[model samples]
Target chain A: MSRIQSVLQALKGQGRKALIPYITAGDPHPDRTVELMHTLVEAGADIIELGVPFSDPMADGPVIQLACERALEHGTSLRQVLEMVKTFRSRDDKTAIVLMGYLNPVEAMGYEAFSDAAKAAGVDGVLTVDLPPEEAEDVAPLFAERGLDPIFLLAPTTTEDRIRAISQHSSGYIYYVSLKGVTGSAQLDVDDVAEKVSRIHALTSVPVGVGFGIRNAETAAAVGRVSDGVIVGSVLVDTIAKNQDDIEALKSSLVNLLKPMREALDELAS
Target chain B: MSVKLTEEMLRALPDTRGHFGAYGGRFVSETLMDSLMQLETEYLKLRDNPEFQATFDKDLADYVGRPSPLYFAERLTRETGGAQIWLKREDLNHTGAHKVNNTIGQALLASFLGKKRVIAETGAGQHGVATATVCARLGLECHVFMGSEDVKRQSLNVYRMKLLGAEVHAVESGTKTLKDAMNEAMRDWVTNVDETFYIIGTVAGPHPYPMLVRDFQAVIGRETRRQSLEQAGRLPDALVACVGGGSNAIGLFYPFLTDESVAMYGVEAGGLGLSSGQHAAPLCAGRPGVLHGNRTYLMEDENGQIAGTHSVSAGLDYPGVGPEHSWLKDVGRAQYVSVTDDEALDGFRKLTRVEGIMPALESAHAVAYATKLAASMDKDQMVVINVSGRGDKDIHTIAQLDGIEI
Candidate 1:
């Protein structure tokens, strides 16, 4: 089974939704990146999403934007992130890793080169925030050829036709945007997200992960109840940004918040 | 100057991969490769379609006020006492600059592609105002990214864009200049690629844009050809224009490129001095490097960090020149020259006094070169210079420098 499928199966057996945490690579420091990755994995993170710092990130919220800025200041590049991921896979091969970011860095690195490097680094999937399913022609094929799944997002504005298209082209899990605006905007509608997640579940057999606005434990637990996985971005990014000098503290705080939410999700599943 | 561009020659000009004599080609992100290939295919199809040509031509004529006049600057010519000087009045284009000529054509193409919004990055705000104007006319949402420094320097343009219903985003990243604004705009394009149309301002950037913008701006040269024949009955001895990303220069030079008899000169902004490391003369001092979206002559330090460029005119303050201009400079098709800020200011004041025409600070560089060229040539020799824009918007800077109240 695929790493994503294995994670979903593990979640099913434990009767708990997956807790996905996102961290911008090299945010605190590139030297501590492998440590943070392992810490997050140990902190109840079923899957870890790594952000590749870009010069300009328009779609990202303030929290992640700050993280990216810090990472860029420390000279974090897609290549550096790949190297970190390779080190990460040296000790832990079971944890699924997804590289989440814009397409420019990947494009600059060349799609085929990036896919090959990512696979060598044990990257399980990719989630380019900007690349839509229609434009994913070359990118999706490159990833699939290298045994890496290309994850796509389905938003509230997506129609049934688009959902079908996204599901057909997508591998790993589908990212369901919980809100209409950017990542940290406070306009997330729980009922609206739940309804959309249910509709998306009916269409795709792949696991559906909800993201974009789950900032706190309450929201994470709420989203976990309806979706196969809960992906928290800005909150975790903010944690790293605030405690950049201390990765252990940041990781512990993230785990402390996610542990109960994962238990709450397990209760719902039971 | 009366030479007509045959369909075959135009096809032969930009060879198979869009290279214009070692100038234009795709040097960009690998992800953009497929998109650019698709765009090249679409552009070639649209190029041959008479219907597309008719629509583009109509917009150029009616909307942009094309066939911009070729006015004889009799007084300025007499002052120079060397050549009879003429001005190709691109300043009279609908949005008060040569920028609109490309925007209108691109907006129409955007509509044809079923795009809902138009996005662009601007340095001097001329391109922003022009893009906003076309978007408003077409009832499409317009988003313009201007560097934070540009927003502060060109506040009136910011207000003008807002008045035209464009969302003027003040980008406060990087060096807070045109290059950074372009970076943000590219990010936006990548995010909204399916629905947004990026209307690049100049004859620069990666493939499709440099070639596409040149095609749209070529009207200036085509009209100059007809007007020069109507008035002087012969081609001018020299074609001079300022190069800021080389859009206007390319527009005015492309039609006369094969006219070996006609000399071509592009003026670069020599802010303080070229050796002082405070000038925007990329062709003069820069090496080839990839920037924004294309490989071009870019001003960079040994570390490859984008170096700071200096120019009195915010419009001309860029670290890179258009790739085509770099090629033209190398291949000897065009001569690249520089004018100091002091000379440009003198030219600005001279044109305002002698010709009753105030040129943009960016255009002053060309005017400065023209004044020198005319003074050095024979009295009967003809010279045509592209007055790229009106200077009304720059009065504040001119006034401040002269210690005059706003």
Candidate 2:
């Protein structure tokens, strides 16, 4: 089993839901990324979704877009991002690291080379925001061959047919965009998500993780009740955005923000 | 994204799923895919519906002032001293540019789809003006997203868009250019997909958009074909047009794609020069990559980050070209070239002085290339150049370039 599948399955056996927190690599600085990854794991993150910043993040709202700008301003390259993953893997071997971003950087690297590099870096999964199942016919298997879980995102607007198609190609988890808008949108309804997740579960056996708007502990716990995982992105990135000048504050803020949500998810099983 | 195309394949291009030989595909987030598919379905159904065609036709003819004249540039031909040159006067169209052709067709489609809100993104603001003009006439709520830089530079067209009753949003993210404006517009559409119809101004963007915008603008080629036969007694030997996101060029070049005898050239802005790494000539200098919902040639750095693009013409200052143009370039059907900013300025002056016509800076790239190309051809041969827009919107930029306050 892949690291992501192992983590998700292990969590399921323990009657616990996965807490996935996303942070843009190189946001505060390149040196702080591996530390941040370790921080996320220490704060009870089951899987780390690290954003590889691109110049144009089309699916993102203002928060992540600004995060990308900050990351790119720090001269963060895709190759550098891979090295950060490698560094984090040195200290933590069990926690899964999923790289989430657009497809161009990997496209520039060539799929085979990127797959090799990602595998070498101990990356567990990749969820490209722009690459749906239709375009990943040739690219997904390359990553899967190296045991990297090829994750996919399904939106609230996605039809049943599309959900089935996406789940068939996806391996680690399906990121159900809980709202109709871009990342950082705040209109997520847990009941709507529950209905969508149940329908998705009926369609495929792949675990479903809900992302895009799980901002606080209540929402995370509410969403975790219906999902195998809850992904929190903008809120964490917004914290970094709020503390650009202070690195210690950023790490502690991430810990403080994530610890409560982690407890909330554990509280659900209790 | 690089798929080879034979002559037969070119005719049936983009296939059903919008693959122009692997260049065009729906590279969008899942939230917008349904809307894109719906737009494509509606567009395909309307394409064959005679009543829908008639409505689009009527709107173009009456509202947009169709059949924009194809006049022979007599003095320009004599000065060039080679081929006889003819100008397709897209500049004479309503809203002072060829952008209205697509806006009218899309607005009509939006109305047919019962979408009351229309959204668009503009670079130089000509498309914004054109879209706003049609939205006002059709009684749809128009919202235009423009880059903060463009909104400041192209203040005239921004004001025109406002006067036409459209809300002009100044996008402040990502260098605040056309590409950034497009991102903002995509976010808006994704947010309001149920009620909004995004009318992309260029023959870029994802699957349906490249094909849809090209079809609407193809009237330029259809008219040029008829006028070539009428005025020159045959089709012109060559076709030339400026390629910003390649809408006007595709509009003028699509009908002639199968014509083996007719050579096509797409002129790109050579801001300083191609070697300077400052120009916006993707087909000429860049490599193929996926961007803006399609796989196309883009000016990107080694890490696949889209590099900043430059041009005297704001419309052409984009990192990527239309996927159709990328396909054509790969298949050897069309030749893409660039003219420097200085040469484009000369072309601007030559047209104004010789033909008494002021062409937009974007179109001046075509004019500059066509002038040089006409010099090499035989005197008996004929060339057609698409004057894609009027130059009034560019007057302020020209004045600023000359260090004049206007």
The DockQ figures for the candidates are 0.09, 0.85
Task: Label model 1 with its docking quality class.
Answer: incorrect
For B1-406, candidate 1 gives per-residue lDDT tens digits of: 1333345665675666656655555544223445556667888888788999999999888888888999999999999888989999989989899999999888988887789989999998999999999999999999999999999888888999999999999988766878778877876765566678889999887678888899999999999988998899999899999987989999999888877788899999999989899998889888775566555787865424457788888788888778788877777778899999999999999999999999999999999999999999999899999999999778878888899987
* Residue-level lDDT for A142 in candidate 1: 80
lDDT of 2 by residue, B1-406 (tens): 2333346866588888788876888889989998999899999999999999999998889888899999999999999999999999999999999999999999989999999999999999999999999999989999999999999889999999999999999999998999999999999998999999999999999889999999999999999999899877999999999998999999999988878788999999999999999999999999988888998999999999999999989999999999999888988888999999999999999999999999999999999999999999999999999999999999999999899998
Worst 10 residues of 1 chain B by lDDT: B26-35
- Chain B TM-score, structure 1: 0.96
Error of 1 at A270 (Å): 5.3
Q: Report the error of model 2 at residue A197, Å.
A: 1.4
Q: Which is the leading candidate under TM-score?
A: 2
Identify the CAPRI category of the predicted complex in candidate 2: high
Query: What are the per-residue Cα lDDT tens digits for candidate 1 across A1-270?
Result: 679778888887877788888888888788888888887877778889888876555556567767777887787888889999999999999889999987657766778988999999889989876566644666788887788988887776677876887799888899887765566766678999899999998998888999877877788878988889998778777777777777678778777766776667667777
Ten-residue stretch with the least lDDT total in model 2 chain A = A136-145
TM-score of chain B of 2: 0.98
